[model samples]
Target: MYAVLSVTDKTGIVEFGAGLRKLGASLVATSGTAGLLRDAGMDAAVIGDLSGVPEMMGGRVRAFHPSVFGGLLYRRGNASDEAEAHQHGIPRIDVLACNFKDLVADDGIAGALDSIDIGGPAMLRAAAKNFPSVLPVVDPADYGEVLRALGAAGGEVAAVDPAFRRSLAAKAFGRTCAYDRSIQRILDTTGDRE
Candidate 1:
């Protein structure tokens, strides 16, 4: 299975990627994530290699390519979608493991709020939108469940189960809601309004 591991939170990610690799899955990641995986001795291919585009603007322009989106959004069983993906050289993305940047307030500035990722959110939303074809995982806590499912399925947990897909959709929506709330709170505090 092709597993994409792009996370702002580096918690347990190296171990998770290593475990996934050990379970016979290909690991794909962005710059920092790829570095972490390599540092942990896990074989991870950089997203740029797949997308053929280097990270630009302080790692802002990574994973925004058609290749990445096609992989995450295309339905495997649909002949048209699969054909289109093949024509565009897009590999199927089975699992998307991601976590939003943790916003932390410090010295009258919110570090985590500032670190809100644009590309990460877009990718997560795309994966969640195509949940029938893609398995989107936002919480590291769900790693064990995923691993268990993969093991049970003989190292092929690419298909998103109905129940798990619903859970992932809920989590994705909650994450967006939380991000909006943070922005609202920041605006409320900074703006001059009653």
Candidate 2:
């Protein structure tokens, strides 16, 4: 399994990645997460390197490339999709462990704008959309449940139930929606939904 880990909340990430490695999974990580994984002695493929795109705009453009999205969006088990994935060199993304940047920060103006996340939510939504095939974990707390399920299946995503995957997808979508709403609220001066 190929897992992607990009998170703002770093709690339990190293151990979670280690557990994934134990289950015969490799990690694809963003710059910060890759540094942490390397510190823990785990091998990880950097997102920029995998995408063949240089990190630009002071590291703002990360994981938005086709190499990343194709892995998350492609359908598995479909002969055409599988053949296309192979032709495009998109590795199968089995898991997406992610969290967004904090929406509220006390450091001032720079922090406020930087809090809005673009890439993280996109990855989450895509992975969630392709559930059962891809487990999108937004909260670190659910990592244990996912690890247990994967361990029980000996690391095969197909062994996990469709309903559970659907539930997780719902959670991923809800989280992104809430995050966007918060951003809207901060941007809104009138305080009305419209």
> Which of the numbered candidates is closest to the native, going by highest TM-score?
2
Please report the TM-score between candidate 1 and the true structure.
0.87
Best by lDDT: 2
- TM-score, each model? 0.87, 0.91
Clashes of 2: 0
Summed backbone clashes in each candidate are: 2, 0
In candidate 1, stretches whose alpha carbon ends up further than 4 angstroms from where it belongs are: 102-114, 158-160, 192-194
Candidate 1: clashing pairs of residues: 103-112, 104-112
Q: How close is candidate 2 to the true structure, as a TM-score?
A: 0.91
